[model samples]
Target: MASLNKHSIGGNIFLLLLAAIFMLMGVYFQWLYTNESNAALAEEIAYQKAQEEYHDSNIYYEPEASIRWLLLRQHPAGYFVPNPDLLFEPTQLNDNTLRATRYAISILYELGALDSINPKTIIEYVMENYLADIQSAGEVDGAVYHNGPYAGFGTLSSRPAAVRPTMDALLILNLLGGLDDPRLDLDRVNKFILAHMNDDGGFWDEHYAQSGRNSSLRCTSFALRALSIIQGHQKKGFSTSDRERITSFVVSTHDPASGGYADFPGREATDSYFVFRAFISIWSLASGDLAERREYVENHMEVDHTIDYLFGQHYLKDEGAFSRYYRDLQSVSSLKATNLIIWFMTSMGRMEVLPEKAILQYMMSKQNRPGEFGGDMYTTYSALSTFSRLAVSTEPMSQPKKPTRHASIPAYFPLMLFSLSLLTLITSYFTKKHEMEARNHILARQASIDGLTGILNRNGFEEGLEKQIGQAIRHDKPLALIMMDVDNFKDINDRHGHIVGDKILKEITRLMTENIRVYDIFARWGGEEFMILVTEAGQDKAVQFAEKLRKIIESGFFGIESKVTCSFGVAMYRKSETIDEFVHRADEAMYNAKHSGRNQVSTVPTSAKKDDRVVEFKP
Candidate 1:
């Protein structure tokens, strides 16, 4: 009886162990099923969001193409050129203008492309050329404008740092994480910026705009941006009266007919640039949440009218580009105008109303090559920026919280379109053949432009040369003509093809543009040769200038695989000499350079000398 009882207890213990094991297995399987369900649900939501983002309406975003074009125009020293036709020419580092670099660097920074560039080289260039004025934007130092004022930034550091360029440089430095840089003086920069602000409650660029106006929306926006960056993100700097005065000043620049702001008051022509500057100043002045900015703007202006003006007026749906002025043709469409308008729209929370597909098409049309947007860094910035902004999500964090912002759109659409159409008809009645005349004037000027290099063609050069000669005669200035021709250029074309030769000429033109004085005349004298009229400079100075150019070309940038050289010929313009005689002397001197080996500057002795001889300047 004791053995039977012990066996029963063992059997009971085994049954309890089996039951616990089965319960554990059930819980494990249930957890596995739940987790699988959750992961599948998450993946499905992600796919839906992606599909929404890449839908038909928002398909114009081509970041890859925009980046390709921008990179193509980038100089080695981190500057940028406006023309891509000069892409393959030999240009020096720090050779291109700061204008394009300012925009290009800003765009690249926005796109998070810092890893692609050497920031140190760029920083060094900026410090030396703009801020410190060591090199002076690829010019010959501060020989001119020696008494330049407020040296924060400018095209040529020799000139006074204007409000626009100064603010642009500061923005670039900020984008480049240059705050830690010791060379940047926030205190000095703020002082320069503050100096531009007038009692009119607007910023004035004494150097940039000589338009006689004391202040403009453009300068005000630039000043405010620089001031904000220098002072940090605090709103305590502007007083209640200051804000009110500013609000009143900016509002006064607005045009009710076009629903855009002008650069100045008194109903100036309202365009994309002015409107953009006005909007930025308005945003910068307003603090707190994005909703507060919208509220502030609404309190001041008929914000819906601005929206309608942008959509049905400035934005040409048919062209996919914006006009610089209202009632302009689609052919007059500008990348700058489109960019500024898009920037404004994106900021105002109205991307849904844009013609995204058309804009993409127009932007891509400007591309000269694969990944090349075929415009300057300004256009590249606009194109790339526009493309990126197109895909921006209108999520809760990305946009304003007000639902009424969307509601106002439907009410303003029909009225805006009708007003635009009516205005166009009225303008046609008043201005008889006015638009045609304006277009013809542009075409006439473009006629003289060299298609190869944006410089003057032979015909254009002749007209300009005659004008300069007259100016020299009037000012009683000594003048010299320096003619330059590529060495072995025909061989380069024969061996490397005409395409390579064309690039060489373009490079030469780029160098001339950088080295020559702004007032000096430069032109393409046809083929691989160019002409320069050195005003107020005698034979000695002109010869030296030619030599400088010879060296620059010798070591300048080469976009191609082959090395290139040039021969220079200079001649002092004899008083009352025929243009042909003057040109012949310079041409003969150039051949003398070719005969005396390549890459030398040869000058023709004056006719007054007993023996007319060719004197060559060599290293």
Candidate 2:
């Protein structure tokens, strides 16, 4: 009887333990499934939120606020002062007076403020006080120019003709339809500008006699823009060849590695002003090749990268203003950087991406609210221009002003459940591990492939280029790099929605992959830009391949009414050049192809013909 009793107890305990184990296993599996589902849901929610923010359409811009800020800077003297509070005092004015006045007038005209303001009085004041006859001064053959403002009266003899002031005055006059003014002699102004053109195809600041300095980018930009405006009023302008030479000079100022323009040759440091001026100069000269000029700017300007750098290094995000340099928030707000950003956004047609409210608030903060000018003349001018641009932007707005939230549970609620289930089953460990591994694999794959086209991304392309460059250098084998961009891709995107545009890119990628050799490494460089690395190929082979690709693209059906075309640039790897320089040469060639005409191949010449670079191949 005692033996029976002991056995019964042992069996009961064993049964209980078995039951407990089974219950725990069930709990573990349930927790694992729930955790995985919750994680996926969280990821999806985050992605949706980000997408909503990125494409938010409820943003609104008030132009009146900006216009009010600009109007506060105006003085009763028919000119804009750096500080309106100083209007009652004897304020010293210089070239900026002319520039500010022009900017203010231009913005007012653009915003329909001219209806309220009497522009005739201002125009007359500027014409009578600023315009000077160069022939009378015996400074040049013919031309009337702005003498720039003087500190005291009867100091006209002391004031010299500067390219910037003259350009500003001329642009203002042109804007006001005052080109036909009896006091303004267009023929004389044209001759004066022509005489200032240096042998190097740039212009001097002050007729080369007053300043006696080398041709500067700033002066050249102003002079070229003025001449371009003059040409619009009259039929005559700089000859095409002369304009081409001027374009070459502007191109030479570009730093390929940085995608920024230097102030002059041998000066590699880039400033926003210099880059802006260089772009304007090229644009003015390349009037006939407008598309090519835009392409050139797009390829060389690196606007997006530069903006990132400026924002990272100099922009005070919290304050919503840019500083002059990195980490110098206390310094006066950098109107130059701020204005550059605005211009860049406008030119790139990316106004929708700007932080409109923040920028507006920052500008308002900089201005004297009640009775004073907010900043210097240029600062006010830049602020006015930036505001005007923001006010006139045509970007669509979202219907609803606020984003809708879909999730009710906290993101961490799954964690609490996970803790409770952790003590349950052994199989749950393996399941979680497997899920993590799968997620990592997906991430790695995504990093290598572009989301839009399923091709190698920019990071992947750069990695491939580095590896190929190392191989080419080690073996001393000839390698060629090819750069190509879809001609007028922006136009396509504008005409068709982004969905169709994306489809076109995917189709183009498929076609490229099918046509290129298996050994050739190809990747999407950026939006509508693709690059190919061809091993064991000389310049001739590269050019031939580029031409072949161009033809294929031109003939391919892109699901649009118009035929798709691409411009290609080819360059053979040089013995001493770095990878960036090599790529830049190819880019330059591509730019030349676009400049020459779309659907063509251009090659950078090898060592023997380095002087005769950028040879174009047309089909």
Candidate 3:
């Protein structure tokens, strides 16, 4: 009986162990299944969302007709916004003037300016006539803006640290919707911003260029906006660090006392005008949880005072919209204020409060008989936007309807997140699957390299040459290309069984490497042909380098049994020349050297005005 009981106990223990193994196996399978299912569902959901957002509506605003008719009736040539007798002329504020004009161009574009004027021509005019005076965005040394009111017209009287012309230019271009223009020098502007970043994650105004961490709300807001625009073109996702820092800076600057934001941290006075800009810029960068900000604004904003100021119905009660509050009190019907309001509302995606119909009517009524508006650029933009929005919204929308905040789509954020997640999964799967393929690529590269010769195979050389020449032009560096062909390479191959010929070529490459500088690039031009790139070196230095390389080849060989020599032709790159033209010049020079006598270098004239002269090598 005792033996039988012991056997039963052992059997039960074995069964329990078996059950536990099955449970673990089941859990693993379930996890695998859930991951696959969720991934597919995520993709499908994203696709549907993309399709929904991409759908364009052919909707028109009903109120635009009234505004257009009014414009036609009063202003025969152009439309304008009403300008109340404001002491601060929008045109007089240099930064305001720059921004206003740019806003005008943007409105004009929306009004079909491209159909009337060439976009490229407009860009050219801005670059040549305007960009110099504009304060560059991002971080800049104050020395660049030392002259008083140099760019944006912000003299000591108006702003203490205002030098935001660069921001103005970027905003203007954005308003014109020309961010993708290849001609725009975004790289330079991006570099400028990078220089001005303070240790506290905010940008300093020109007034405190490098003194310390003097942050301003206006500067930080504008900087964030410019960075957001520039980063859109970059392929790499912006790291969370960048987003976090910008959000913190903007949030810290908020004024607890006034229910508004100061231009920067520690600022005593808070203004709603700068608060709007800061919020808009922060939103563009996707810097913070905007939902929280919206909650704060709803619960804390000084609503009554803010509203009174926007329409000029109450002076001093309303914070001036764009850094000129005191002056704004004089211009009761100034269109700059109206445009500022519209811009803020639009940026926040809160169109309901903008009084679209009323603003449009006011703007249209101000038009002169000559078809131009009496108001400045700011007024024209506000009026046009109000009219256009009204024309497009087929849905009968009313004024001052509290919008459901944080309801609008980010347009890029969600899509980017989805794309990034998808990419991560795909990359992980492929990395495992193509582990062997990755090895094969490395092997393939090795195979293309002739170990002894140190020159690329014909395929590699062709690819490398194209890439190097392209890089040279892109960086605007000097490129000296040399194509060398052995005058009697075939004879050497015929006499020496190709093995000796290979050794000769290998020796030639070794000799060239020793004679060339680190920046100078050399590759086997082709069968007996060779190429060299003299980076940042002028034509004279290139010629000297080429001569030295040719002499080394003339004197050196693999074995004393065989004497080998090469002829070289050099040519400096010309802006207008194609790759073929540039290479052909080198080839012609090489042939000239071979005919003139072997073991020599030949070159073309580098002077821009000189005729293309070919000089044969004596050494």
> What's each prediction's TM-score?
0.48, 0.51, 0.37
lDDT of 1 by residue, 1-619 (tens): 7877788777656544543444343334433554555666666676567566555344333445555667766666666666566755555233236666778787777576767777776776566545543234432234433443334776554555666777767777777777557777666566566666667787777555575438778778888877767666222466678777777788888887778788888774447677777787777778778889767767776666777776666776667888777644343688878988888777777665677778877886776654445345676677667767776422223221222211222333333333434343344334426756887998877878899999888888889889888888888889889999998786678788888778778888888899999988899898888999888897778888999999999887767666688899998877778999889889988887876777899985334255454567875
Cand. 2 TM to true fold: 0.51
Evaluate model 3: give its TM-score: 0.37
TM-score for predicted model 1 compared with the true structure: 0.48
For model 2, residues 434-525, the per-residue Cα lDDT tens digits are 87899999998888788888889888888888888889899988998999999888778888988888888898899899999998898898
Q: Which of 2 and 3 is the better model by lDDT?
A: 2
Give the residue spans of candidate 2 off by over 4 A. 1-59, 92-95, 130-132, 138-158, 207-211, 292-335, 341-377, 380-619
User: Model 3, stretches more than 4 Å misplaced?
Assistant: 1-101, 129-163, 171-185, 205-213, 235-237, 266-271, 287-333, 346-374, 390-619
Pick by TM-score: which candidate is best?
Answer: 2
* Model 2 weakest lDDT span, ten residues long: 148-157
Q: Going through the candidates in order, what is the number of backbone clashes in each? A: 3, 5, 23
* Model 2, CA-based lDDT: 0.68
The top-ranked prediction according to lDDT is 1
